[model samples]
Target: MRDYVDQLKEKRICSECVGEPYLQDQIEESGQEAECDYCNQTGRTFTIEDMASLVEVAFQQHYERTETQPDGFEYAMQREGIREWEREGEETIDVIGEAAQIDVQPATDVQEILADRYAERDPGAPREVEYEFEREARYTPKKHDDAEWHTKWRQFEHVLKTQTRFFSQEAADTLKEIFGSLDGLKTQAGRSVIIEVGPGTEFTAFYRARTFESDDTLQEALEAPERKLGPAPSSLSKDGRMNARGISVFYGSSDPIVALAEVRPPVGSKVLVGRFDVTRSLRLLDLSALQEVEAHGSLFDPAYVTQIKRAKFLDRLSRRITIPVMPNDEPFEYLATQAIADYLATEASPTLDGILFPSVQAGRGQSNVVLFYKAARVQAQDLPEGSRITASVASQWDDGLEPHYWVSEEVPETPKAKKADQYAHFFGWDEHNPVTQDNRDPSLKLDVQSLVVHHIAAVEFRTTPYSVDRSRIAMLTDEENRTGDVPDF
Candidate 1:
């Protein structure tokens, strides 16, 4: 009888007896049938001894013993709060059931099994201790501290928009820290966010669009399309998503349609789109890559938790930076992004020439690129040193057909070379007009053959439509509406 009683305590528990999906699957694959001690019915199960490893792991990953607090007497003498004397953790049996999603009896049995197993190692140890299971406070597997980053970013935005725009030392320092942290962020696959653009690279060309309100404006642009279609000169530049007022930057797209969408031209307007070839190698930060940034490490590592939090924060920050802002709100809203552009272009280590971000106006997969002032300069068309040049346009059409337009540049005879004495009289004559036209660093060459003109007959908008519902309610009687009184339905 004594031997039988001892054997009953170690009876096997079937897979059906386990509640956790993973444990159930693990047991089903490896366990054999036996009479479950807790359920009292014969079923497939593992003995308590066989389940020890799994139980130990589950507790290690999800539970921590609650700390003991000072009693009321100690609190009065030590100046501790009322909470110090209050019970703090869930009951041990309740915790086991909740953590394993098991019934009360099974939880109680498991607790006894664990207690017995633990007692064997240290017979004199106390058994009155309680444990607390992690619920909402569980360590995130992805490891990003999104709340902290979000709070910091919002503070930065508020400071830039309301308190200071030009000379906020605090804001500058904060932005610098944020960017510095993002410098080496990598995707789970270990790919860097920095990308190269120029000859031989995938992103060798970009399309820019300019909308014209009238035929006259269109013709004017056709005459000097390269100059007109390129980035606006600093003086004529307006405040944009990535630039301040009077600060010029080339805003183009990998896809021409994306470029047109970005400009948001009105109906019945003409859009002149031109492709420009990147003239030299340049580095750009790829904002779209931020979505895949992740940190992978053991949950037990303290540093891994911080790493994952940063990764999650960066993923969210990418979208926040690229979200579309209405024209009316752009002045205040664009300050943060403009500041980012400035920092990446001028202050970042291994300085980037621009940023490549997803096009919010065109939806996902399509991207837009912004080249800072230094990398946005367009290379002028080469011409003879002493020759005068003129632009001409010819339009031809047959009956009931669309008119075809052609733009051509005509150059006259070159002027005779001046004598040595004549050149000596005007020293630094060549210096007066340097080789680089407009005194700007040239980085792009206009691709004349890729020029395209789009006539906008109508504008299309993609939107989510919601139905508005109206409800009517009768006024309540004074008796029924009495303060703190319940009304019968």
Candidate 2:
């Protein structure tokens, strides 16, 4: 009767008459059935049981929610617009048609929501009544799964329509928190936004799987350092995760403006599950602590994020210098130098950001490197380390020999906190590295700046892999000598 038809999908509704207070008054003289004016308008009538059931349902629904719901959700449930809600109490209510449409401020907290409503309105105004509204369903006022899903989707839609840009899970979570607490979150239509995210594991969890438009601004933003998804799958095995999220535009033939959506990934696995410690995040990153780049806790780590950005920049501007495949008997160090020469001879490959190799080591293991040599092609012999991961930035970086190349250990780019939020201190093992000689270092004080390449003795090989640091664990295998580079590849 209040003309909420626009919000409804189907008109055939259940429950009692529209408003409260206007009930069938007993005719003392005739003792005949009478209908209230409000009931007549709704085209339906409700009994006391119906009213009780509705209120019970509404309160229960509003309780289990992590997101905000709409005022309309409690139409039949609220008596005199919540003038009659008292735990284990009784009261009656009046239903004013126009008054129902007026906007009401949502209660700030549970205490406020359960407080007494004693405003003196009309003499026959609604009053709180005690009614043991028995739960109809087997579950006592349990939230409907479909309804919960719809509520979250509605919140997502609201955000998408309001802002046209990428969104983060933290932003989504923050919005949900606000909706749950702030009354200003309610929109003109009487609905509120609330985000609910599940643990993301499958590809569907990521919204970018769907295609977007070719907007110039978007393209430029997407190309930015933060926008570009790096060469890796983002090994969130520890967090420090970074990715871009955008809204999906669905254009229909009829009305263009429709439901909105802010694409966001569900929450990922927690770092604690992976034995990660947040305390270690307090340290700065250097060669000694680079591999410890993986943040330890569930919190978003900002420092880990810095290293990720730096690595991406280096990888982007990095030039790939291909090293040749050395035979088994050859020393890999010399061949690594040869590949460096060949790397200098050829023009840089557009797609090849860096040269990765599966060099045949004298030992049972194999390794990879990026060389910058000019027509240098030969086998390796008596390389100090049986196999090593070394990198050389031709022309720009001059460290090793004549052409100037640096052969250092190939450490993984440090992973960061989920959304670049905090600093952590490490709390693993005894004080081992020189950077953290003092056991009193509260957080992980040592850090790793650049990786160093050191020769390995052949004895360390036996289908065995070792972790140079926590972030990078490596193993040498016979099959590694067969294929190379990417694990699956």
Candidate 3:
């Protein structure tokens, strides 16, 4: 039989600390040798007190690490020191046979015994509480569950990924399966029949959805409290800006060719062609319908398809530059020109030097293209003593006088005159005087006289938007005049 101290070492508690120091001393003083001749080993024989003390010490050490008692105390004790006494009918097994067999039952009822011993110990001992806690796991594949939004996003992605047209059979079937009410639309073939008013009365314009910067506008409109389903046409004005129908196109390119390629249609879609600027990110109109316009070109010709990728040497260097016209104010326009002038003064002037037929036009009127000249800077010190356009004097409108209102010199003598004020209010304009001068505000003053142009550079002319009809046509540049006449194709 192995002693309590030696047997405990074979278990996880390999340290020499075993119960009270006095109990260990008592076992050492007994001088009885515990030996197993078959295994050729000798060890001290432990008394009943020694065995109980060993269990108490082992329990506390285990609690220090885990903050709980050992899960199976009985099995632990049996493996360490305690042995079961043989019954009357049972024959003595060999040493190896006894070591091999594990009695399922514990040698002693350790739980009942340890309950009393642990209770006797001081409450505020070192091995009392566990400070470290196991953190909750983040992503466990087995714990994953799909959410409602996930399913919705997946359906949306499927449509976009497959490039499904709204009128396509697949799109119709999918929407019908999801909504149930759309099944009736299948017989309509996604087209509407229009009754003509006269000989030529028809939808002269293609009514496609206007693209917005974000979808929040549509959300707000749909959730409005007064909106109803399927109202009469008379209830809504023809030019209403309510945006009752939500339509959006997702393309960053302003080129008509690129927009057509993005839609991937069967060749008859209406296309919008216009540049995106600050006031309008997309100022396009669906005036032109797609048609089989003949392309005349030989792959070997140098002038053939000068648009970037089609060219051999220049390759991707071809570009269309868009400069937005400032509001019809002389001061602000001067400032904008200065910005462009300062840009040309830098090394990057070569890029913008290539702009051809850069002309100025009225924002809201059909006017002839004015020659946009590179202006010179004039300081206040360089002007004469008392010039009207000089910087020394301020404008007459800056006197800080409040605007005076009164009836016109000629009042309305008839029904139309009586409704003049109401008509003015309806049109959101002041009837007394439509124009007001408030130049005291610093924004109106001309801070600088001019912007200097640094150097001249080579520019390739492509097209010009004619001031007469507002139609863009192809042109070239030469020595006589920088902007040349349109080439005959």
Q: Estimated TM-score per prediction?
A: 0.67, 0.17, 0.14
Candidate 1, which ten residues in sequence have the lowest lDDT sum?
134-143
Q: Model 2, poorest ten-residue lDDT window?
A: 269-278
Mind giving the per-residue lDDT tens digits that candidate 2 earns over 1-489?
213321121122112332222222211222223443333434343332332333334444322212122255454456457543323311112111121111111111111112221121233544442122211111122222333334544454444445432344543453333122221222224432111111231110111111123233223322221111111111221111111111111110100010001111123210000000112211110111121222121111223233333333222212111222234523322322222222222322211111222222321122122211111111112123223343342344356333233335433355332331111122121244566232332211111121111111222223766768556556757787667643751
**What stretches of model 1 exceed 4 Å from their correct place?**
1-144, 181-183, 296-303, 385-402, 415-440, 477-489
> Candidate 2 lDDT (Cα, whole model)?
0.24
| Model 1: residue 141 alpha-carbon error in angstroms | 5.1
Q: What lDDT does each candidate get?
A: 0.73, 0.24, 0.25
Clashing pairs in 1: 13-45, 13-46, 14-44, 14-45, 143-308, 143-309, 144-308, 144-309, 145-309
Strongest candidate by TM-score:
1
Model 1 RMSD vs true structure: 13.9
Count clashing residue pairs per candidate.
9, 55, 0
Highest lDDT scorer: 1
Candidate with more favorable, higher lDDT: 2 or 3: 3
lDDT of 3 by residue, 356-438 (tens): 11112212211111011111111112222222221111123666643221111232344232223322332223546636211
